[model samples]
Structure formats: structure tokens, C-alpha cells
Target: MSTVFWAIVVLGALIFVHELGHFLVARMMGVRVLVFSLGFGPRIAGWSRGAGETEYRLSLIPLGGYVKMLGENEEEDEEKDQSGHPVVVADAPDSFANQGVWSRIAIVFAGPAFNFLFALMVLVMAFMLGVGELLPVVGSVSRGMPAEQAGLRVGDRVVAINEQPVTRWEVLSQTIKRSEGVPLRFTVERPEGPILLTIQPRVQEMTNIFGETVRTWLVGIGPGSGTEFVTYGFFSALVKGVEHAWRMTDMIVTGVWKIITRSIPADQIGGPLMIAEMAGKTAEQGASSMLFFMALISINLGILNLLPIPVLDGGHLLFFLIEAVKGSPLSEQVRLQANRAGMFLLIVLMAWAMKNDLTRIFSDG
Candidate 1:
């Protein structure tokens, strides 16, 4: 329940900000927005200002919200459809479609931009408070394992993996994971003296929570006092925040590439259920922790929306780029078809995620 509360709050806040970006910009440009809705479906509670706009609020739906401008859709009502053009509505306010191309572009891009800004803010907060970092230490070396066979001891602290100096546990883990089953030389400081150990991990096949089997290398040992915490001030935090954003963006691109390359199975995808579970766990940590998780998720949302698939911001951007090149927007019929195809793909992905979630819950670890 705590998780659900935090998740909803974060989701609602980010979504409200996203829609508000559009609403505020549209209003600033003198666009006559007929409706400004916070959420979709029937209006649960709402009030309309006589001169400004009709704001119809709605019941709680965690999906998303939108701002509707005058004559946004091509199919206008007969009475309202003064001009019978399929693309542009004649009575459309001169703000949205009427403004210069650049202004129009800014409004469309602002929503995602704000999301990234929000994430940066939260990350800055996290870094300022101090992030936990783990040191690389060998706690318990598995018997008959690579480390044991290579004569590594319990108190040996790993100083470097090959030529890579290890400061944090995460760096060590990533280096090892990337190496797969390859043998690597670890320089460790033992009680007696500094020693080098050649450890080769065995690839272990195991089922994930989603029931999908993945091959990962296993070195049987527990990480002992593996991490140390460090805090930063404003300047450092901002730098770290930017660095974190870059790393996450890289990961997202890599994940996408893996999916395209078929290296990552589509069945491993997750949806709302996985998000909720993550939210719950993060909430248990505290507000700051939950906020941190929320920021990361927001970044993912912002980037994912910009992918060049249909019905997404990226899809729209791609079309805009093409329009800029070809001298006009794609025809409505062609755009609509593309949207339908995107929707179909999105639904299938969601269903697969839900299935994976269920499998994980029922399975014994």
C-alpha cells in the first residue's frame, strides 16, 4: 500500500507536469484550449472558468493525461467544421498550428524536456544527500571455485580487475559480467602480501523471475563490506547527476539495440506490475529513495516516448524530420495507419510483461 501510494503520487505528479507543459505553452501562445483535463475518462470533479477554459478533472487513472486544443482532430463536428479540410481545421486558433514552425516544435518537445529536467533535479537531490558506494572485497571464496583454486583468501581485498582499478562493487560487478566466462587476473591485497589470482567463472544457466532462462557467470563468494558511502555538495551532485543521466541513456539505447538484435528476448520485458512492485520496494526505504527511483523511471519514460515507433513522441519527431525534408507532413491516412500498427505492437508488449510478472510471483526462488 505504501508503495502504491508513492507510485501513484510520483506517476501523477510527473504526468501532470507533462500535460501542464503543453497546457501552459499553448495558453501562452494564445491557443484557445477548449478543455484542460488532468486525467482521462469521465469527469469525476471539474469546474470551468467563464472566460478562460473548461477544466474537466477525472477519476484516478495511472496511465496518463493530456491537454486538448481547439480543432486538434481532423474530424470536426459538422457545425464546427466551417472548412472541410481533412488536415487543418479552419476555425483553429492561430496559436498552435498558426504559429511559426519553430514555435510549434518547441511546444511539442517541451513535455519530454521537462521530464528530463525533473529527473535531473531529483538526481541532484540524491547526490547531495550522499550515495552509497561499495568497495571491492572478497569475503568468502567458494571452495573448488575459481577464486579458491586461484588461492584467494577471505580477507583479500581486490584492488584491480586486470588493468581496471576497482573502487566500487558496482564497477567490479559490471566488469565481471562483461567478461562472462573469460579468465581474469585480479590483483588483491592479502594479509601476507599483494598477490595476483587468475579466476575463471563458470557460466550458470538459471531461470529469472519471468521464467526466461539466462546464462550468467557465477563466482561463488559473498561480497563482504563491499561498499562504502560517499556524499557530495552542489557542484559535485550536478556533475554526478549529469553523469548518471548519460549512463542511463546509454543503457536504454543498449537495451533497445539488444532487443532489435534478438540478443535480449522480448519475453523479458516488464510493464505496470513490475513498476508497482519496484515502487513498493522503494517506498519501504523512504521518501527520498522512492523519489530517486521515480526520477529514474521518469527518465526511462521520457526516453522511451522519443523512440521512433508509431504513436510515440519519437515517431512524431521522425515524421516531423521527414516533413522538414520532404516539404510537408505525411498524409493523415498514412499517419493513422502507422499509429494503428504502433498501438498493436505496444499492446502485445504489455501483455507479455503482465505474463512475465505473473510467472515470477508464482515461481519459487
Candidate 2:
């Protein structure tokens, strides 16, 4: 029950933040917003404000939300009310369709931008509040592994890898993974003093939580049991937050490229179920953990929406770019077909993710 609740809360807040971007931008650009809805499908409950200018709705479906603007459908000059009465929309001066290509593009791009900004804010807060992280202290080593063969003891603290300083376990793990099978110089601090050890990571196949086998480099050393809470000052936290968000964006882009190039399996993609489980587990860890998780998800959402796929913000921006270059918008028929294709692709992708989620659930059970 708590998982379901948190999932809804997290997803709902993200969606709202995304849609709010479009809503605010549209209004700022003089486009009349007719409805600001929190969800899709039939309206469960709502109230109108601004003298019925905008209808604020909480709909039955919780999966997604949208902001409807005047003349959003280019073919429609007027919108109908609940009574099926034809209501005249605002004039072309204030209609979304009448706006310049750049304005429309800005409105569309704002959604993804807001998601990234929200992630930055959340990360900053998490850093300020102090999040627990694993240090680079080796607690155990496999007897036959590369680390053991290199004479790395259990009490040795890894200070650097390949001349690059690494203070956290994540950095160390990433460094090892990127090394492939090449020998890396490991700078360690032992009880006596500092020592350098050259170790080549062993390439091994490992099954992830989703039961997908992925090949990764391994040194077979684990971090110590306890975690250290790392906190930063205001300016440092802001800088770190921005850096973290950028790193996440880069990682997601690389991951997507790998998937497209068939370097990563498509079945590794996760959906709502995986998010819910992660949310619950993180919430159990405490507020800081949950906030960090939310920041990660927000970054993911921002990057995913920015992909140059039709039916997404990136797709809209692509159209605007073409319009800007060609000095005119694409043909209505072409746009319609592209949107349809995009929607089809999105549905297929969602179905595939759901299948993977279910497969992992039953396999774990």
C-alpha cells in the first residue's frame, strides 16, 4: 500500500511539474490555456478559476496529464463546453496555433527543461541534508579474484585508479567497468603506508535483478558494511547538484546509444512496476534516499523526453527546427502521420517495458 501511494505521489508530482512548464510558458506567450488537468480520461473532480477561463481538473487516470490551450487542434476554431455548446475560443492573437514556431518550440521544450531543473533542486536538497554513501574501503576480497592476486588486502583503502582519484565506491566501480580488461594502477592506503598495485579486471557475466545477463568487468572486492553521510555547504551543494544532473544526463544518453547499437539488451528497460518497487525500497531507507531516487528518476524523465522520437518534446523541437530552416511548417498530413507513428512506437515500447517488469517479478517470486 505504501509503495502504491509513493509511486502515485512521485509520478503525479513529476507529471505535474512537467505539465506546469508548458502551462506557464503558454500563458506567458499570450496563448490562452483552456484546461489544466492533472490526469487523463474522464474528469473525477474539478473547479474552474479565472472566471471559467481555465478548468482545473483531477482526472480518473493517473498515468499522465496535459495542458489544453486555445486552438491547440489547428483544425478547431472553437471548443465545446460540458453541455456540448460551442464556445468561441480566443482570437488568433492569443491562440497557440497563431504563435511563431519558436514560441511553440519553447513551450514544448519547457516540459523537459522543468524536469531537469526539478532534478537539480532535489539533488541539491539531498546533498545539503547529507546522503549516505559507500567509501572506497575494501571489506572483503575473493580469494581467486584479481584483487587478491594483486596482493590487495582486506583493510586496504583504494585512493585512486589509473592516476584518477576516487573517493566514493560509485566512482571506483565506474572506473573499473570502463577499464574493460586492461590493467589499471590502483593506489591504496594500507596501515603501514601507501602502495601501488596493478590489477586487470576480469570480464564476467552477471545476472542483474531483472534476470538479464550482462557482461561487466570485476575485481571481486566489496565495500565495507557501514555508509558515511556526506554533506556539503550551499555553494558546493549547488555545484555538485548540477554536476550530478549533467553526469546522469550523459550516462542516460550513452545508455540509450548502447541500446540502439545493440550493445545493451532492450529487455533491460524497466517500467512503472520497477519504479514502484524502487520507490518503496528507497522510502524505507529514509527521506534522503527517497529524494535521491526521485532526482534520478527526474533526470531520466528529462533525458527520455528529449530523445528525437516523434510524439515527444524532442520531436516537436525537430519539427520547429525544420520549420525554421525551410521557412514554413511541415504539411499537416505529414505531421499527423509522424505523430501517429510516434504514438505507435511509444505504445510498443511501453508494452515491452511492462513485459520485462512482469518477467522480473515472476522470476524473483
Deviation from truth (RMSD, Å), model 1: 5.0
**Candidate 2 regions with alpha-carbon error over 4 angstroms:** 76-91, 142-151, 158-167, 170-220
Query: After best superposition, candidate 2 residue 363: deviation in angstroms?
Result: 2.2
Local lDDT at 218 for model 2: 94
Q: Write the per-residue lDDT of candidate 1 for residues 1-365, one digit (tens) a residue.
A: 77677667777888877777777776777766666666667767777777445565654555777776664553642223437544455345543556555555566677778788888888888878776676788778778877788787887788898977988777777777788688998988877788888888877687754345888777666678755667889999999899887777677667767777787777667677778888889888765577688787878778777778887667767877777788787898999999999999878877888998888777834
Per-model TM-score versus the true fold: 0.76, 0.83
How much is 189 displaced in model 2, in angstroms?
Answer: 5.6
| Clashes per model (N, Cα, C within 3 A) | 5, 0
Candidate 2, residue 141: Cα displacement in angstroms equals 3.0
The candidate that wins on lDDT is 2
